[model samples]
Target: MTGLAKPQGVKRMQVVIHAGAAFTDDGRLLGSLLANKAALAQSRSLPLGPRHSRQFVKVMSDSVIKDVPVDDAQEDLREIFPEDLNAERLIISSDKFFGPRRTALQHGQIYPFAAKRTAYSEKLLEGAQLELFVGLVNPGSFIPKILMSLHEDQRESILGSTDLSCLSWLNMIDDLGDLAPGVKLTLWENEDTPLIWGDIVRAMAGLADDVALKDEYALLLSLLTGTGKTQLLELIQQGTAKDRQSLRDSLAGIFEDHAQPEQIEEELDLPGWNSDIVSAFSELYEQDLAKIHTMPNVRVLHP
Candidate 1:
């Protein structure tokens, strides 16, 4: 990463930061990850981290969200997290860095939402010792949520001015690359988050496979039906304990058979789309993800 380097005497430092492509994380991942604090204490690979992780990050990066002066922020933050803090890494997340995502504003397909704002946030964080993590969603469902949340007139204005048919988030990711070169990027599809919840938390915390990520199954439980969850647990324990890959295969089979119809259904009940168009947009999104996987120094989280 292109930021302040740690002194030789200190452990080489790293920071894991998640600035959401809005509506993706919603702070739940952070909540679930922090729940592992007790087990994390016993983890050998994970480093000792900030005592109040969420608070420390929020306080230090509040300027990035609120658009305050970076210089003032640097001075004030040092007071709160003096050099004596023993943490080698920090787990930070915020959705606000991308600006108001659910607004009645659209800037067209090529430059849809938060392009400039995201670049600005990166600029604000310039020279900060941190790596970047982001969750991207398909514009297929993303647009509906934004329209639903806005005033009718505002929504109309956005629809009138923007070409939703060609929307893509590749530009936004590219914007980050242009603005913050040398920063490590970790990516995952928002829709697949439940399947890879444990993996995401472990990667974000810079922990090893053995360091358990608490509430790893929390997202799956919320998304799956009661029968599915029970069946999955049974499959996991029915025979002798299975390897991670075997367990994952068993879980996937269960999920495929029993995933709730409502969870799979994407009924916007709003305008500007049909089943075919939505499907096409979704395919395009998958393609975008495939392209992202090919980028150098980028970590694409998987199940």
Candidate 2:
């Protein structure tokens, strides 16, 4: 794999493809071929005959917006626009779409077509250099569902961060991979982890007609991660045969109500104790249980 010399200011563009249709099997195959061809063509195309610098045009996807500036107009168009209009320029065409919805584009300058028209009502045509062309394409059945799962607020936050432009182009792709896996693990481990420890405490207290479950819930809160909860539960189980059985039964009942048996098994099979889960426990401890004893109808059975 030959490394393409990093283009000047290439680090500024960190575009991610959130639209699911962009990752189809055919799309992947085509994109791979295009990337390779572009890379190879770029190397040979350099070192112009009479003019040492050659004018080259490259078509990039919306993912490129992550690294490139989208907010500041000057910075966003620096590479594509002429430094000196007289100088022989390299025209790079970025096929990025800016819309009101969540996109990989990080720069603030490029507004969604609708936003551009609204914000700069009169200057829309004069200020906007790029034209948006929409085509009817089948984006797959699950595309809408995937977009919906990525909440609008969270998506907007990620897309709107100015610091996001500093992120490496490669890292943006890696982040998408990490996000899917992280969410999947979170779902799988929901049973073992104390994600809903408060609800469990309330339910148990109501059912048992005793507030002792609140203390147990507080203890369980300290074990927020799957590994921590699993290990802590094991330690508690070792106290006595009766204690072990009782604790196991309580946990099993809670798990059954919240998650499927397969999910519990999957959580158990996951490797290692991630520190992020520990941090989650710390956050919950600070935010939710700062004054656990002061709460009404709550009893402290175990610290």
**Best lDDT goes to which candidate?**
1
lDDT by residue (1-303, candidate 1, tens digit) is 223235667555555667676667667876775678655544322322334444444544466557677666555455434565455565556654454554423565533334444444344444445577777778777777767777888777877878777678777667667766656788888877877777777877777876656567767766678999887667645854367777667767777788888876667756756777778988999898889889886788876
Which ranges in model 1 have alpha carbons more than 4 Å from their true place? Answer: 1-9, 41-69, 76-83, 102-106, 109-128, 238-242
Residue 109 lDDT (model 1): 50
What's the lDDT for residue 279 in model 1?
87
Model 1 lDDT on a 0 to 1 scale? 0.64
For all predicted structures, in order, the TM-scores are 0.80, 0.21
Q: List the residue pairs that clash in candidate 1.
A: none
TM-score of model 1 (CA atoms): 0.80
**lDDT per model vs. reference:** 0.64, 0.29
Off by over 4 Å in 2: 1-72, 84-96, 100-131, 139-145, 148-303
